[model samples]
Target chain A: MNLETPALIIEEGQVRRNIAKMAGIAAACGVALRPHAKTHKLPEIARLQIGAGSKGITTAKLAEAEIMAEQGIDDIFIAYPIVTEAKLERLATLSRRINVIAGVDSLEGATAMNETALRRGVPLQVRLEVDLGFGRTGVPYDHALELAAAIAKLEGLQFRGIYTFRGFFMNGAPTLELEAAGLEEGRLMVELAERMRAAGLEVRDVSVGSTPTAEYAARVPGVTEVRPGTYVYYDRMQAVLGSCTLDECAAAVRVTVVSRPEPGRLVVDGGSKTFATDVGPGAPPLHLIGYGHILEEPDAVLERVSEEHGMVRVPEASPLRVGDVLHIIPNHICSTVNLHSRVYLQDGGQMRELPVAARGAIT
Target chain B: MNLETPALIIEEGQVRRNIAKMAGIAAACGVALRPHAKTHKLPEIARLQIGAGSKGITTAKLAEAEIMAEQGIDDIFIAYPIVTEAKLERLATLSRRINVIAGVDSLEGATAMNETALRRGVPLQVRLEVDLGFGRTGVPYDHALELAAAIAKLEGLQFRGIYTFRGFFMNGAPTLELEAAGLEEGRLMVELAERMRAAGLEVRDVSVGSTPTAEYAARVPGVTEVRPGTYVYYDRMQAVLGSCTLDECAAAVRVTVVSRPEPGRLVVDGGSKTFATDVGPGAPPLHLIGYGHILEEPDAVLERVSEEHGMVRVPEASPLRVGDVLHIIPNHICSTVNLHSRVYLQDGGQMRELPVAARGAIT
Candidate 1:
């Protein structure tokens, strides 16, 4: 396919296989699969996941959920706390139409949403986001019970169980022992849910897991649902973390060699803007050497990047030349996908454009 | 302004002041100001720059130049090498309508563009991008003269001059001695232009300088133009590099504190997706301590970020709470602006939305 350079290409066959494999894993473990829509911000991909036995979809932002809802995806779990009045009002309006589950971490956030729910006369379904040592968001583990009780007391909100996100962490740093981390993540969340249930608070949906921890977390009995966003389009990070093989990585960026300035360095048309800088080369655990993995020349590393130029380090004897096309599997596919407005899907012999419907739905 | 969290805000007063200041500097130095449109990615902002005495606009991609041309900003310079056929065709098409200048670093790239220009019957005005130790793009300094002669020989291409990008480098690393670095950057490019002119090559426009080095580079005798992108809306990096004060930073991401998960930690709704991860905390010369600088609580550091949450570490005695609004000046505004579709322009008491028309124009 003669497409433009720096184009995001998603292979349909691998994506289908990835979806099926994850769905089968959840099915085998007898847990619900609510694949996170943040990875592939397309409504079409969400529908495919739902068709492949995913119970629902989970989004990192309210605006993404609204886009999915507008495109006819009914059930969406916004696994992010909505604190702003504008977002809360939008959430309430969305909940009036479809099954929208909001995330609550603090009393102030819950109270604000409760007021919006009460004003709209639509009861908001919320799940307390337990902090699983990610230290990014969510309620602290020690205070989860207290906040859950407080949220349960809100008249216009239904406290539907709890959820947490702990992606492969051990002793404050990213760990390669995925099994140990995933088991601990599942065990901790399960124990919390049992404790909440024992205290007479209703805890139904115990959602947990990122792409790396999903299957292992699903092995735990009480993890009612698993939300693995990147499994659909496994990236270089996932491949290094032993979650999926490099071949299973569905998304790849097709870039052209624009300038071979020096013997060892080849500059490509793609850069930090094409493949995001969120996951860096020095990232821990699996300190995968480059910004991306070039499919053809495995030895080449995308060493440095400016806004529009990717400086690639290749063997001096390498046959790479200016105007040559190369496919790169990005380190993190989710953020990489978020950078583009649309992606080309290569399904069998046919290629088609899929608009990232929620491309910049950060709000 | 009760706008939603994670909204990109551009202070119109600061933006206008920044434009005039840079324009004034260019005027005083007797060099043409061609502000790089890659920073703001908005035609309105480009028009503002042109109105403030900028000769033209510089873009990193041909697609961005197309957008600027379509928006009626005219005289464009795509300071990036166009290697692909599709992009070359687009560049030729753009050149036909407006005075479009393309960048040429390699003989292959020049030949390809020459082919397209020949086919389209338009002589493409080209600039030789000399490698000034950035090691990202551009031709090697030693081979630049040879390449310039070859490019000038191409029948369908006009070798206008030479350009290079060396932001801040002393020896092999980014240095704090901006004056020395900027002076060296200008001196080297001027010497190259003089050498090319002595060889009977008609070299006129010698463009150089990023935001940090623009004024200093413009001081050199033979440098005809300055193309500083980030000065229009100075970011944290520019401020830290002494290009502008923190108050001079016009663009910021307005975010709401969503979760005070821990005593010393507050989570904001914006994360890597909102404020891009292109410029990290450990960036050289100035090891900028966080993702962004909070205008409200200047002491708080946005330490860690997930896809949707920014973990801020604040003083124990800080009075910040959940639902509080915070404005953040991102480390790099160019990549940050590319992430958003629209930005709120705050001019005095008036606020309005300006669409980032060329936001995802990375071809």
Candidate 2:
């Protein structure tokens, strides 16, 4: 295909298989699948997911949601707490065009969004985010009902549901203990949903998902939807987390070996700017070492990466030479895909370029 | 200026001051200044550097050089080894429009470039890269003369000079011992230039520079040019390395405090996608902790960064609220700048947006 070195290659068949697998899991668990668009950021991929039984798409920022909505994606869930007036205005405008659901944790944040929505004469739907275990954002599980009630009472805002990412449960492959933890977290979220509903707040969607805990969390009785982003293109992190195998990874970075300066030392065109310095979510296990898994030389370690140079150290008897091509499975596919402007889709040995529509929309 | 949160801010006055300071260094050392465009990819910044006594501009990638040339930057030195045919063809096209000098380390690479230039009937200039202890790429210092002789004999290619980056000496700020090491490396490059010249090769330029050793490398006898990119926007890494004071840093990322999940733990909108996970060129010392230096709270440490969330741990007495805006001096300004699509220029308190023209030009 004469693809350029350091290009992102997405095996279309593998991607479709991944999407179908996740969709089947969601179906088996009786939950709606709305994959996160922040991972691939392509409307084409979002469309494929929607076609594969996804109800909508999830975005991490308002900018990403706007980009998706512009490309005919009608339903978007921005899983970020929008705070500023500028973003609120954009969200209000977006709400007028599409079905928009935002994740809000605080009463003040909800009030701000309500004010914007009221001023813009648009009805805004919001999901009260709960900190199940990951303490990054969302109201505390103890305080979730209170915030959800406040959001329901807000003038122009509708409390649609609740959303929580199982980031704290993200570690190595799901152990029996980890599965039990996920089940307990799921029960807590279902309990929160029941409490919110009892408080006269109509909770429709109870969202729970992370690549590691998606299987367990989706099976929760009251969880209505799952938002597993990395499942679309499972990476080394997902593999190490026991979510997928390395061979099942749909995306890889194709790079040219530029320099072999020493016996076991080789340099590739991709570096931190390409692969990123993400080992995995949470702490990596002992088997998951190095920055990425080199497909050409599985034993070779991506030792270090500067902006534009990735140093790979192989065995002393390595047969790697300059100008050789290799593929790298990144540690985190979401951030790695976000780094490139375009990604190539490989379908039946034919290559097609897809623009990463929301590459740097990190608002 | 009521700016958006998680925005890149470039202080115009400080940038000019940094430019003038580095240009002054080059002038004092009797070397031509060519600031690298890879750091601040804006052509506006390049024009300013040239206006501040720089002879031309330097780019780390051919794509970056092409961008500069499109914006009327005539003289460019792509300090990266170009290997592939697609890049060679682009280099030929670029050489036809402007003055282009590429860094070459191998005879085969030189032959490929020479053949492309010959086919296109365009003259291409190349610098024989000498391994001055960086060991990333380049011909060994002892074998550089032979490669230079081969390149000089090739048709349609001009052997312009010998160049080396003092990457090994790039650690903390110029200690006396580090300066001596820089001087020693410079001498080795100068010796290589002499050896090439004696072997019937015309060596017009002897280039050496890195932010840490620019001063000493420039002062070496017979060195004609110096390229230091990060001097345009000094960062926390440079400050920790003793190259610049915190006040001298020209660039910062302005972000709003988004979430205060717990006591002593705050979350900002900027994360690994904004600040990046770079602690600068060499290993960080003890005092240099965290991903960036927070402006409002100097003692606050950016402890962890996910894709879109930067978790900050401040002192127990932190009075930060939900919407307080703060600027962060990134650990490595170059990589941080690359992440953003636009950088705001603060000139005399007036805000102006400058599109990062050559950003993500890693190919």
Residue B326 lDDT in candidate 1: 93
Per-candidate total of colliding backbone pairs:
0, 0
Off by over 4 Å in 2: A168-178, A198-201, A280-287, B168-178, B198-200, B280-287
Evaluated at residue A303, the lDDT of candidate 2 is 74
> Tens-digit lDDT track for model 2 on B1-363?
667778999999999999999999899988999888888998898999999899999987888898888899999999878888888999999988888899888877888888898899998899988876555677777788877888899987988998887673333333434477667777888888887778777899999877867888888888898888898898887777667799999999999877776678878888877887745223434256777888889989887787788878888789986767889999888988888988899988699988889888888
**Candidate 2, chain A: TM-score against the reference:** 0.95
Clashing pairs in 1: none
- Individual DockQ of the candidates? 0.82, 0.53
lDDT of each: 0.91, 0.83
